[model samples]
Target: MNDIAAIPVWAIIPVSLLLIVGGSIVLIGALGLLRLPSFYQRIHGPAITVTLGAGCLLIASMIYFTVLQSRPVIHEIIISLFLLLTAPIVAMMIMRAAVYRDLRAGKKDAGAAAGGIYQFPEESE
Candidate 1:
């Protein structure tokens, strides 16, 4: 007998809901990436949504697999931990790089809008 068939309807409902919600959140993030006007703004879409979406998907996988195996499957927790740790750091690094680049190019507005935290030497003409 296939393990998939062993999953009860009660377990299936939440798993399906998680998958759908996760997918929808990811789609919204993609749309935000495409629709947002600026790089600073665009990064937020994926950075925020990816974490939430992946979390939901991971939970769905855990529930589905646990139900199939008749055991508690918690490996997703580690994956989630890594993702939660890294995603924001990566996004911050990318934003910092962009801000640095903009500052080096004499665009003070970018640095200013970035809370004026970066100090770049003014280019002598």
Candidate 2:
């Protein structure tokens, strides 16, 4: 569009930079997702994308929109807030579920017992 090309060179540079950085963050998060071992580590991998990558992308969007319209637009904050609250809850639930499954399967060592882990009584077979 004509409007898109009409943006100042300086503004275009920053926007391009923002997009590059945001994309890099997302790429790193994806690599982390694939490289990290175990369910816990894998959970953390996507979280990096959810938190940092999403934040950077949102910032880039805000910058682009603000420059284009010359107005204050901040609706991204709502998304950030929802993600901040929900990501942790979702990650925690996944971790807890994995822990429960591991415990049930006796993969965890006996000395690893701690608070909040599920426990079962010994069976007399």
Candidate 3:
């Protein structure tokens, strides 16, 4: 469209760069999620995407819209706020569900499996 082309080259360049960087972040997150072998490893992928990748994309969106509107458009902040509010809660719930499932299955190694660094001994009952 004519309007799209009317954007100054400087604005276009930065916006395009932001979008590319944001997209790359998201792609890397998805690839990480898919390529990881264990659920614990996989959890990191989405968490990284949600925290970092989404932040990048949101910043890109904010920049693009601000450039397009010739002013600081803050609508993206609402979405960012919503995401910030919910993402961690959802991730925690998901991890809790996984742990609950493992516990329900009576896997004595659940704590050990979840603990990536410090070793947790299996409880004796």
Candidate 4:
């Protein structure tokens, strides 16, 4: 758009930075999900890291649209509010469910290495 083209390079730099940072945060979170050893540890990926990533992305989008359109682009606030409200709740629910399942299966506090993950030592032959 003409308005976007007219925006200053300073604005563009911040927008691009925010987008890249947000994307990197999301990627790191996804990688954490893949690399963490247990359900509890993995849950932190989307709950904290992804939420932060989405916040950064949303902020960048807001700034870009606001400056580009020469108006206050505020719908992103609603989305951010929803995300803030739901992320922790969802994380807590996931944790509760996982904890319940572990307890039901008699694995509560079974190990100490992050989310009750056990590293069993092999016996010498």
Candidate 5:
């Protein structure tokens, strides 16, 4: 097997910390998705997972590869960028669909208006 570069202890410490923290955040986000009461609230859980968790993981990957190879290993940024951009759109669509479905079912909730249409009061002249 080819010899890998001996990573410095100092570098390893921070990288390890990053990996642990990111993994924990990802786990918490997953827990929130399972525990949250509403669909809208749950929509935000994976955003946190992708943004903080995936972002740190990619950074860790980039750092480790670059250090071992003695070159810029920034290809991991593509995954990070894709997650950051796509997570929000997917979350929003899920939330919107949930709202539409609930409205269609006509469940009476405080925020949900009649016929899913809000009636704004007229301002006095």
Candidate 6:
């Protein structure tokens, strides 16, 4: 469209590069989820990379919109902030749930893997 064509080369280049890099990062994270051998390992891939990849994509969006509208478009920052704050907490909660499930199922290795931090319920004789 005319709006896309009107964007200067400088802005276009960074936006394109950001898109490519962000897409690649997200792809890698997806691959990691599929290729990883265990749940613990799998969670790490997306947990780390999704944040970074989304950050890159959000930055790209901010830049593209700011350039297009000729104003400081900062909506992405709020999304980015929310992502930054919640993604890790969600990952941690999921991990804790998994560990608790494993412990409940009598998987001693899960507690060991968690560095003995989880309190196992006492068994009454």
Indicate which candidate wins on TM-score.
Answer: 6
lDDT tens digits, residue span 93-113, model 2: 877777777777877442233
Instruction: State the lDDT of candidate 4 residue by residue for 1-125, as single tens digits.
Output: 77777988988998999999999999999999999987777888878986789999999999998888889999999999999989999888877766666656666474333555542344479
Position 82, candidate 4: lDDT: 97
RMSD of each: 2.0, 3.3, 3.1, 6.6, 5.5, 1.5
Backbone atom clashes (below 3 Å) for every candidate: 0, 0, 0, 0, 0, 0
- For candidate 6, the TM-score is 0.91
lDDT of each: 0.92, 0.75, 0.75, 0.82, 0.75, 0.91
Instruction: Write candidate 6's Cα lDDT for 1-125 as tens digits.
Output: 99999899999999999999999999999999999988978998999999999999999999999999999999999999999999999999999999889888887677555577776877999
Give the Cα RMSD of candidate 5: 5.5
Residues 1-125, candidate 5: write the lDDT tens digits. Answer: 23233886766777788899889899999999899986667667877686989888888888877887889988889888898898888877766667667655655452252243532344489
Better of 2 and 4 by TM-score: 4
Cα lDDT for residue 72, model 1? 95
Candidate 6: minimum summed lDDT over ten consecutive residues — where?
A: 107-116
Per-residue lDDT of model 1, residues 7-103, tens digit only? 8999989999999999999999999999998899899999999999999999999999898887899999999999999999999999999998987
Q: What is the TM-score of each candidate against the true structure?
A: 0.89, 0.78, 0.81, 0.81, 0.79, 0.91
Clash-forming residue pairs, model 6: none
TM-score of 2: 0.78
TM-score comparison, 3 vs 5, better candidate: 3
Give the poorly placed runs of model 2, Cα more than 4 Å off. Answer: 109-125
lDDT, candidate 1, at 97? 94
Pairwise TM-score winner, candidates 2 and 5: 5
Q: How far in Å is the alpha carbon of 90 misplaced in model 1?
A: 0.7
Q: Name the Cα RMSD for model 4.
A: 6.6
Assess candidate 1 and give its TM-score to the true structure.
0.89
